[model samples]
Each structure stands twice: as C-alpha cells, then as structure tokens.
Target: MEVAQGLCGRGALVTGAGKGIGRAVAVALNRAGARVTALSQTKADLDSLEQECPGIQTLCVDLGDWEATEATLNTVGAVYLLVNNAAVALLQPFLEVTKEAFDRSFDVNLRAALHVSQIVARQMIARGVPGAIVNVSSQASQRALQDHTVYCATKCALDMLTKTMALELGPHQIRVNSVNPTVVMTDMGRLNWTEPQKVAAMTSRIPLGKFAEVDDVVNSILFLLSNQSAMTTGAMLPVDGGFLAC
Candidate 1:
C-alpha cells in the first residue's frame, strides 16, 4: 500500500489517542506515513489502536500523573509532531464546583499539556530538530456556556499556553498551535447532547447548523502538524462549524 508522504519518515506522539478525535488524529498521522506513538489512560483503547496499526507503540499512562508522563516521554526520540489531545471536561456551575474538581480539570487539561510539551520540547531543542505541537482545545475557551465554567477556563488557559510556548520555543524551531472544536460527536458528546431536542437546540446556535465530527478536529490537527503549515504557529484554529463566529 502506498501511504501519503506528508509525514513520511516522521515520528509522532499523540496523547489521548485511544478514541474520538485523538484516535482519528492518530489514524490520520499514520495514514500520512508517520510512525505514531499513541498514549491513553485506557489499556484496551491503546491495545485496539496497536491492533489497527501494527508496530505502532501504545502507552497507557494518565497524563494527570506528571511523573509518569515525564517517564513516558524519556523513551521517545525527538518527534516531528506532538499532539496534546488529552483532556478532561467538567460541566458544572461555578457554585457547584469543588476544589478537587477544579484542580483535576486544570491538571489534566492544562498542566499535562505543559508537562508533555516541556519534555517533547527539550528533546526537540537538544536534537536541533524543527517540530510542531498541536494542542486540542475547545470552543468553550472563547465562549461561556451554562455549566461549563471549569472546562472553559482550562481551555482558555491552554490557548494562552500555546502562545507562550510558541514564543519561547520558536527560536528552537518548535511550533506550537491549538485546535479548538465545538461539540464533537463522541461518546462524551452523546452523554451530553444525545437527545434529539437537545441536539437540535444546540445545532440551531451554530451557524453551520450542526456539530463537528471527530474527523473535523483530526484533520485540523494534521494540517497544523504538517509542513503545509510550516509558517503557522501560535494560532488557535477553530474547527467549530462557525460556533464562535455566531
């Protein structure tokens, strides 16, 4: 089979790559001919991705655990692309939020990306290789929705982190960008927006009149990681079906 050459001979690490947008991104990268290292907290998901793509490495590690994340990156080489797609969402009112919940959201959604980027950036810098880091964010970062304060806050922070990292790492030839998507049709989405009435109501708000698919998010990440976007950095690309524009 002749694979695409955009990322051929390149190595990539995609966090939370067991399912949904993460899984789709991993498959996209693999189809583009990159050697992918898929990381997720679920052993079964990782095993599944490994089965789908023989010789692909799968690591089961909770990104919330900083030490374990650091250890996992040590074994990998200088990567051509790093997708910080691991995240946790909390849909609760500010008054209902607990300190533990807040911390967990920030830790997993923001701090984990920081830790992984640091390790990956170090390797890239040391090896003097040009690379890209694509952070998976959300439309919630820019818009305030009911019962999504915590999730929105974390994504907002992630956007800032992307810019700061881009500034600091640019000289080292490391590009940092973000992909913000609206409600994606994933397991999580089904749990939150499965009702026909609810889906219709939400779709009405989006200018595009529908929620985004997992592939919509994956394709954007792939574009940012590829040389086609060599000049792009620190950009928060929205795959939100005009949700933010409305």
Candidate 2:
C-alpha cells in the first residue's frame, strides 16, 4: 500500500493570511508540502507568515481594491487550491449602518471573493487543473446577530456565490464550498468577546460548550481542499462548535 501524496507540488493561495484563521490555513498547507502563497494587506503579517513557514510566498494587496486585485491575480501563476478567507465586519444597528460601511463590507467580504474566484478558476480551467476552493464564511450568514446586519448580509451572499460557482465549475472539476464558523478564539476574537456576559451568552448557545479554535477551522478547510472530500462540493460545513445545530 502506498500513502496518498497530499498537496505536494500543488500551488495554493490563501487570502487574509495576515492573521487568525487565514494564517492558520496557510501554515497548515505549507506544512503539507503545498507551494503556498499567502495574500494580505499588511506586509508585516506577510513577513511573519514567511518567518513561520519559510518557503511559502507572500503577496501584499488589498482585496477591496477591485482593479488592483484583478491585476495582482493575473500575475499569479497556476493555483490548484484557493482559500478566500479575507473579510471585514462592521457591526452596527440596522438603522445606524451607513451606506459607506455597508458597501465597504460587501467590497471585501462578497465582491472581492467573487472576483478572486473568477480569476483563479479561470486559471485552473485554462491549465486543466482540478482544484478546490474554500470560502471562509461566518455562522452569521445563517443566523443574524444584533449589530451585524451588513456583515450577515455579505456572508449570506457569499454562501450563495459558493453554490453558484460550484454549479458552474463542477463540469470543469473545480469544487467550491464554504466553512461557517462561530466565534473563533483568535487574538482579536478574545479581545472582542472579553465581556463575561457576552461570552456566557454566546457559549451557552453552543452545544460543544465552547468557541472554536483557529486549528479547528483550519482542519475543516484542509479537509475540503483535499481529495478526501472529492465528491463534496457546494457544501457549507459548519465549524461552529455545534452552534448551528443547537
């Protein structure tokens, strides 16, 4: 019996690789022997990622910048796996949300992901490379939270985009899916959820009795990208500590 060659020699791309879930995914993929390229708006974060995983490449660009993102993607070589993990959340009451904030949220969370998919999927098709794409969405996409009106909307739209992309790209052997996670215990997440009342309220709702860790979500992303899930596409798997089920 031979061991399966996993991600070795494959070209992988991960957005929002500057921090949190994105950073974890990039590191895991690199360790699995993929030629990983991490994209982030912050050069410092990219530098840190490179230090953490020596041979991985890094790209500095704001996904919200439409033209620049497209141009940057065009320059990237063939990519076999893509993880659209970049997103921005502006939590405000429905009526208090300004048009600018709403648009900006969509710019990064939804529009940018769509554009990235188009460019990368095109490259895969032209190269005849069977690939996988995982979009990092939030549990907010399915259940609304107070002060998360705009953020919720964008994630919901991203899930739909995942389905549509999967439908269209399936014929070409390109699988598209998404992972919806609850509050992940990243550095920023800890600061934001520090209020005891907030923590208790959120945790009580999860059947698992806790929030997610970065590696938890990263493991799901890697599973979706690997051949282990070869027949799974257009699926939205939850890494939410059973929040959705509860």
Candidate 3:
C-alpha cells in the first residue's frame, strides 16, 4: 500500500499572506514542499515575510481591483492550490453602516475572491489539472455577531459562492471548500477582543470556552488544500471551538 503525497512539488498561491492566518498558511504550505506565492496589498509585509521564509515568492496586489488582480495573476505561473484569504472587516452597527463600507467590504471579500478563483480555475482547466481552493470564511457567516453586519453578509455570500464553485468545478476535478473560524488571536483579534467584558461575552458562548489560535485555522486550510480532503467540496469546516455548534 502506498501513502498519498501531501502538496509536494505543487504550486500554491495564498492571498492576504502578509499577516495572521494567511502568513502562517503560506509558510506551512512551503514547509510541506509546495512552491508558494504569497500575495498581499502591503509591500512591507510581503518583504518581511519573504525574508523570514526564504523561497516564498511574493506579489503585491490590491485584490479589490479585479483588473489589477487578474493582470497580476496572469503574469504568475499556474496555480494548483489557492487560498482566498484576503478580506476587509469594516465594523459598524447595522444602522450606522455606510454604503462606502459595504461596497468596500464586498469588493475585497467577495468580488476579489471570484475574480482570482476564476483566473486560477481557468488555468487549471486548460492544463487539465486537478486542484483545490480554500476560502477563508468565518463563523459569523452562519451566526450573527454584534457590529458584524457587513462582514457576516460578505462571508455568507462567500459560502454560497463556494457551493456554486464546487458545483461547477467538480466536473473538472477542482475541489472548492471554505473554513469558517471564530475569533482568532491574531494582532487584529487581540485588539478586537481585548476588553475582558467583551471577551467573556464571546467566549461564554463557545463550548470550548476559548478563542482560536492562527494555527488552528491554518492547519484546517492545509488539510483541505492537501490530497487528504480529495472528495470534500462545498463544505464549511469550522475552527470555531464549538461556537457554531452552540
């Protein structure tokens, strides 16, 4: 009996890879023997990541712009693994949510994912290759959170989009799935969940009574991107410590 290989010699593209879970996923994929390309809007972050993890190719692109993102991806080599992790969270009360904020969130969170996935999937189809895609979604996509009106909406839409992509791409042997996470203790997460009262309020709802680490989500992304989840698609795997189960 032969064991299955995991991501060795494959080409991977991770969006929003300059920070937090995205950065961790890119490094993990590289460690697993994939040729990795990390894409982000911040050049400084990309440079720092490239320095820390030698051999990781970096690209700077504002994913919100479809034209720029498409053009940039066209210049890169074919991608077998893609992580649509780029997102912007503009927190506002439902009544206070501005049109600008809504449009901006959807532009990067939903539109950019579609634009990038189409490009990658087209390349995969043309080359007659099997591939995988993981969309970095959120528990908020299923459950409502305070002041997360826009973010939740975008994620819900993304989940639906994931389903549609899986449906269409299945014939081409392309698997598409999403990983939904609760509050992860990244710099942004620490900043948002700092107040003890707020932290307690949120954690009390989780059966595990804790927040997620960046690696918690990153490991799940790796599993979906790797051959281990070959038959899985259109599924929303939660790294939310029972938050969604509650």
Instruction: Name the best candidate (by lDDT).
Output: 3
* Candidate order, TM-score descending: 3, 2, 1
Pairs that collide, model 1: none
Residues 1-246 of candidate 1 have per-residue lDDT tens digits of 222335777999999999888988888888888889999999999888888988688889999998888888788765878999998877788899999889999999999999999998988888888999999999999999889999999999999999999999999988999999999988877787878998898889898899888878877888888878888899999998898898
Model 2's TM-score against the true structure: 0.97
Overall lDDT per candidate, in order of appearance: 0.88, 0.92, 0.93
Model 2, 1-246: lDDT tens per residue? 011145777999999999999998888888888899999999999998888888989999999999999988887778999999999988899989999999999999999999999999999999887999999999999998999999999999999999999999999999999999999999999899999999999999999899999988988899899888899999999999889996
Global CA lDDT computed for model 2: 0.92
Worst 10 residues of 1 by lDDT: 1-10
TM-score of each: 0.95, 0.97, 0.97
lDDT of 1 at 41: 97
What is the lDDT, from 0 to 100, of the residue 46 in candidate 3? 98
